[model samples]
Target chain A: GESVGLHLPTLSVQEGDNSIINCAYSNSASDYFIWYKQESGKGPQFIIDIRSNMDKRQGQRVTVLLNKTVKHLSLQIAATQPGDSAVYFCAEGSTSNDYKLSFGAGTTVTVRA
Target chain B: IAGITQAPTSQILAAGRRMTLRCTQDMRHNAMYWYRQDLGLGLRLIHYSNTAGTTGKGEVPDGYSVSRANTDDFPLTLASAVPSQTSVYFCASSVAAGVGEQFFGPGTRLTVL
Candidate 1:
């Protein structure tokens, strides 16, 4: 879906497990991608971002991998803590388009202790 | 830092009414954006301004209008409110567009009756 009005996909995982959320993008010109974590009743917080020029980038406990070949992106969260439980979103920004971002349908991560 | 502030944290409006959602950013960023969040979908851009005095329509610009006459204020106006327009609206500003991190307002939850 183009807007964030679609149903969110959900994933249930045990605490201390690894979580992987995937996103598919349609625009190949997207060069900058970022993963955001949004808790209930709050705005999205920046997680990690990767450039199309680079295949991968990592933050403290998160990693973002971009595959320009197939227009795919994935976010990996290691040691998925309960605090990490939130809606994970993948947003891509097109360098060719003055950095306008196109967001993907979010995946809700539920970490059960 | 009160980076961004949205007025009337939440509001309820009647159908066919005129309503304006206000967003302000103190970071002095050059770009401001308005997005409406629904249940499970991605954050579709309603409208964006790269700088003061300019605005552009986004994917879901219908039923919404934006104005950026100054560097600090970007208000979203709903000509005639409808139930379909009820959602949590977020205001964001970035130093630059793209992978540049965007600072978000707390968000205004609007419900149309």
Candidate 2:
């Protein structure tokens, strides 16, 4: 069975702190992974992505790390701000050519000022 | 530019009724997808289109149908609405399939009684 799951349901962090969100996927064949951010009443926005060939990828204030051996993926947000409060989801892409994705349950991060 | 737009921000409908959710993208991407988001379950793909004339069923496609008559539009149709179908629907588009980033719409909240 293919399943993508998050380690935490919620995370509360103080402003300017660093936040790390963890995710795990059961599909070893999945070669591509992506992170998404969803705010209240809005659809998800793409944050970052990593391929099985790479161990890490960084974007603006976010970093995505992939550990293929354990099928684990993590998103690190630096200097977490109040505007960063949102639900984050990790998705794994299938081996097919269509880039079909399986999303994780999601972890809600609350950045308190 | 409006990357992606979904019609009817929110809707309340009775069970057993038919409903259609419209999705359009101004990016003129070759791939479009429909997904439903639910509490604790994450977002599940309902259907997808690789091009203007090709469509495929996704993980949770049993209760939904879709059509992609053109590159900009991919509409999802529910033959008979059920309470279980209540969820926020999102439409996404990517420049190409398999390895590109996806841009998501705001989402449409649907409720059934």
Candidate 3:
């Protein structure tokens, strides 16, 4: 079955450092992708998104890079802070499924002070 | 705006019991979705509604049902809950299906004992 997956289950970054979380997807038909941050006891919140046509997209303190050839995606956080610690998930969406999203097993990012 | 609202932040139910998770969106989006988040599985789509009065099954829709009676609500029902159904359930809405961003609600955590 087509699925989205992450490279690591957990990541630790020192405060003021940069953090990167990697993900790989199995479906070539996926045209849209998104990154979400889920804090403890809270629902996932949108971080950034990119379309298949584009390779990268940037938000306030986050950047999402998509490598269609390798079916890979990554989210990079700049100047990691304590508030940035959370479970990060990458999701894929395709026209075939009406753009419905399929999420990947998350990567928990912990910002160490 | 209360982008999305879910009922009963948490629950503990015996197996074979029936449960209904209510979701409401104030954004008036045309697309609504139900997803379950497990420890290692990430978020899996359970059901979706593109508009009022229409619904569709998602990747893991078994043992679950949903209805979109109006533009503001989409409720997910479990006929006979099982232990395997214990997870955090989330409701999200988008301006339209297959495009744009999705706003999520505070999830409902269910434990089927």
DockQ of each model against the real complex?
0.77, 0.86, 0.90
Clashing pairs in model 2, backbone N/Cα/C closer than 3 A: none
- Candidate 1's docking class is medium
Where does candidate 1 stray beyond 4 Å?
A: A1-8
Task: For candidate 2, write residues B35-87 as lDDT tens digits.
Answer: 99999999999999989999998889998999998999999998999999999
- CA displacement after TM-score superposition, residue B59 of candidate 1 (Å): 0.5
Chain A TM-score, each candidate: 0.90, 0.97, 0.98
- Model 2 spans > 4 angstroms off: none
lDDT of 1 at A34: 81
List, in order, the clash count of every candidate structure.
4, 0, 0
- Candidate 3, residue B90: lDDT: 99
The candidate that achieves the highest DockQ relative to the unseen native structure: 3
Ranking by lDDT: 3, 2, 1
lDDT of 2 by residue, A1-113 (tens): 68899999999999999999999999988999999999999999999999899999999999999999999999999999999999999999866646888999999999999
lDDT of 3 by residue, B4-109 (tens): 9999899999999999999999988999999999989999999999889999989999999998989999999999999999999999999999767888999999
Query: What interface RMSD do all candidates show, one decimal each?
Result: 1.1, 0.9, 0.7
RMSD per model, one decimal: 2.2, 1.0, 1.0
Give me the runs in candidate 3 sitting further than 4 Å from their true place: none
lDDT (0 to 1) per candidate: 0.85, 0.93, 0.94
Candidate 2 lDDT:
0.93
